[model samples]
Target: MDTVLKINNLYVGLKDMTIVKDFSLDIHKREIIGIVGESGCGKSTMLKSIVGLSDNNVSIQKGKIDFHGVSLRSMDQNQLRSIRGNKISFIFQKPDYTFDPVMKVKSQFFETVKFHTDGKANKKDCYKRSRELLEQLHFEAPDEVLESYPFELSGGMNQRIAVAMSMINEPELILADEPTSALDVSVQSQVVRTLMELRDKTGVAILMVSHNINVIASMADMVGVMYGGRMVEYGDAREVLQKSRHPYTKALLDAVPAMSQTMPESIEGAPPRFSEILQGCPFRERCPFSENKCETEPAIQGDASHWWLCHKQ
Candidate 1:
């Protein structure tokens, strides 16, 4: 598969505190790479940094993000904007924040279509495509949805619309920051299915950040486990999820409730805050397998396709 996105040694910080440190990953064409981690571990920040959406206080101290051969880090505001919604799109966690409550869905969607196409596409063609995408995602009434205001629709409806909107340009890559976080279980399942179908049909690569382990297990071809703003484990999804080498990755998988198990075992102790400076392994405080070597940062272990940053591994 072709490499669609490449992130190398990225370091992102807000003012005095660094959140993402020495993180690197690659996403291939038509592939889904799921990043699963606890809140404030820089999962969302990673996505924002990729699209140049980080706040004024946030800074990319060091890194190179290449989208197909283009250097994202060197791009100016205009350059970033042109590529953001056209070549790369984002699906935010909050569906409610994505739309203008006062505007009808039709007007908002039309504006998006025009923005991506540089006003070359007519409303007739845009509407036709919109309805088709909505129908493909299992929407019963695309016409009704297009006519309704965002405030009038349910959360699930708006989320599906948000997903549909991100697909408007048929972007080469989609950065999803907990896209199903705001929905209920059933709705989350539907949205995941929709995303899977979209990938199958359009061959768009995805970099998704989610706290839900099961969601990652269901959709990701590659998986990266993050802790304290660092990638602790990364590999092919099957190996990372089933034959996990990192203690943090195993803990996350163990936390997921199973029908066969009496109860899920939650990891003890909270993830260290990014603001705190740690000398050794970030997971050392909570790692059950921690040893003397864990007091010092361990070297990464494993092959090119599967690796873990841990002493035990």
Candidate 2:
């Protein structure tokens, strides 16, 4: 598998406070990497930085973002814009805000195709392409969806359309920031399956950020557990979820509700404030297994494929 995107030692900050620290990962062709963490843990911020969409106050302080051997960190606005919606596409959490409620879906889809193609593709050409992608996403009547306004469709339908639009350019990578967070359980499954099918058919790699552990477990080939804007544990999805070594990872899994279990277990204490400089493990304060070694920053432990930040095995 070819490496589509790579990040090494990334540090992102909002004003003076660091939001993401020393984050690193490699995404390969047709692969799905899921990032799971609590709200405000920098999951959304990290995704925005990848596409050069960071807010006005936020900035990348260190590290490299390389796409297919090219450095994205050094690119200017024009350079980044050419690649953003073409080679890399972003699927925001809220479908309601992604499209114009007053505009017909077909017109909006055509506009994106035109912009990415430099106006080479006419409305007819855009319609053909959009219809094909929508059909693949399992819309029985693709024409109806194209003619309807965004306000006319259900949230799930709109989100699926958002997925289709993201694929209109045949981007090599898709950065999804909580794509299914706004939907109900059943709708969430549909959207998840649609994304998985899209990968299978188009060979597009995806970097999905979500707070739902179960959703990540259901679809991700690899998983990264984050806390305090840093990855506490990362490995093969099955390995990290079943044989997790980091206390934070264990706590996250335990917090998931199970059918046989009477009640879900919750992790004690809130996440640390980003303003306060972290000394040791970011999870030390809430960790039941914390020891003297945890007072000092723990070294990376475990093998290449599966690793964690901790003093204990």
Candidate 3:
């Protein structure tokens, strides 16, 4: 597979607080990587690091992020800004916050176009392009959607528009942070379908962060189970979701409510506070199969494409 992104031994910290420790992953072109973990497991923190938004007291303690093989960690703020949205974009769960009530949707669309295009862009041309993007995403009334304010449209519509606008920049990778958490099931499925279709057509790599396993199972090419700032397991969707190796991964997989009586049970115990760095396997405290070996630091081991960071593995 053609690699688009590589995160090597990436450690992100806020002063003395380490949110992501020794994280690494190679993302292939056109791949949708689903990242699952309990809240505050560094999923959001890792995404922020990728987008150059890890705020206050945070710095890359030790590691590098190579986007298309260029070291993003060393890039100055200006250089990072040049790459941020034009080559990389983020889609949040809600779009209302992104749109200003004082500004029309057309204004936001043109702003997006202006950011991605040279200053010679015309308003009429941007409108045409915006409509094309909306239509591409299967929005029926593209014109109305482009004209409506954030308060006027439904939550789903605004989210779809946000997605369309993100793609308008032609980002090489989109880090979606729970883009469907607020929608109904049908709309959630629709949004996921739209994303998958866009990837199929555009070949943009996506890292979708969501706690919802069902959503990941539906859209991800690879699945990563994160717990306590560590990637417990990452593998092909088929393998990780169906035959999870790490106990934490298995417990997460089992937690999903299934029609069958044999679904895996959710692990008990709260995720450790960010101030407390993990001593051993992060999940050892909650693992049912934990042993003495788990008390010591565990290595992330296995094949290049399929691996887990666990003592038991």
Candidate 4:
């Protein structure tokens, strides 16, 4: 598969505090890459930076974000806007925040379609495609959904609409930040299935952030485990999840609940804050496998396909 998006040695910071450090990733066509980490580990920050959406305070200290061979970091606002939503789309964590509460859903949907299509798609065509996409995601009465305001819809419904909106443009890449984190178990499963089917039908690559290991295991072709704003382990989903190489990755897997275990165990110590700069390994304090050498920062080590940032890997 051809690579759709590439992020190399990304460093995003705010007021001298780094939120993302040395983050690198490659998303291939029709593939799904799941990033799993505790909250504030820079998963969402990285997603935003890739599309030039990071907050005002956050600066791209050092990085190269390329989409389809185009240098995103070098693009101006208008240039980035031209690529955004047309070639690369985003599914924000909160659906309500993505839309105007006062505006009718139909109007907003049409506006989005028009922005991407440059007014080429008429109202009829936009509605038809939107309804079709909604129905494909198991939405009932897609017409009613379009007429109602975003606030009128339930969380799950709005989330489905968000997914539909992201798909409306038929983009080459989709960046989703915790797309299923706000839903119930059944709804989460439904959303996952919808995303899988969307990928199958459109062959669009997806880079998703999630704290749920089960969700990542179910949908991801590749997996990246983040710790203290850096990728601790990255590899084939099955290998990284089951045959984890890094101590942090192993600890994360151990923290997940299984039927065999009567009680789920949690990783010891809280994750280091984004502003807390450490001398040694960022995870050294919490790592059970830490040795005297761990007092010094470890070099990243592994094969091309599977890698880890640890001395003991």
lDDT of each: 0.89, 0.92, 0.84, 0.87
The parts of candidate 4 lying over 4 Å away from their true place are: 259-262
How do the residues 142-224 of candidate 3 rate in per-residue lDDT, one tens digit apiece? Answer: 89988888889888888888888888778889889888888888889888988998899999999988888899899999999
**Tens digit per residue, CA lDDT, model 2, 107-209:** 9898888887788879988899999999999999999999999989999999999999999999999999999999999999999999999999989999999
TM-score of every candidate? 0.96, 0.98, 0.95, 0.95
Decide which is better by lDDT, 1 or 3.
Answer: 1
* Worst ten in a row by lDDT for model 4: 256-265
Comparing candidate 2 with candidate 3, which one achieves the higher lDDT?
A: 2
Arrange candidates, best TM-score first. Answer: 2, 1, 4, 3
Candidate numbers, best lDDT first, in rank order:
2, 1, 4, 3
Compared to the true structure, candidate 1 yields what TM-score? 0.96
How far out, in Å, is residue 122 in model 4?
0.7
Q: Estimate, for each residue in 1-313, the C-alpha lDDT of model 1 and write its tens digit.
A: 7999999999999888899989999899899999999988898898899988997789888999999888999999888988876889888898776788888887777888787677887998888888888889889988999999998998888998998888887899999999998899999988899888989999999999999988898999999999998999999999999888998988888888851144788889999988799878999999989899898988989988999999984
| Model number with the top TM-score | 2
Which of the predicted structures, 2 or 4, would earn the higher TM-score when compared with the native?
2
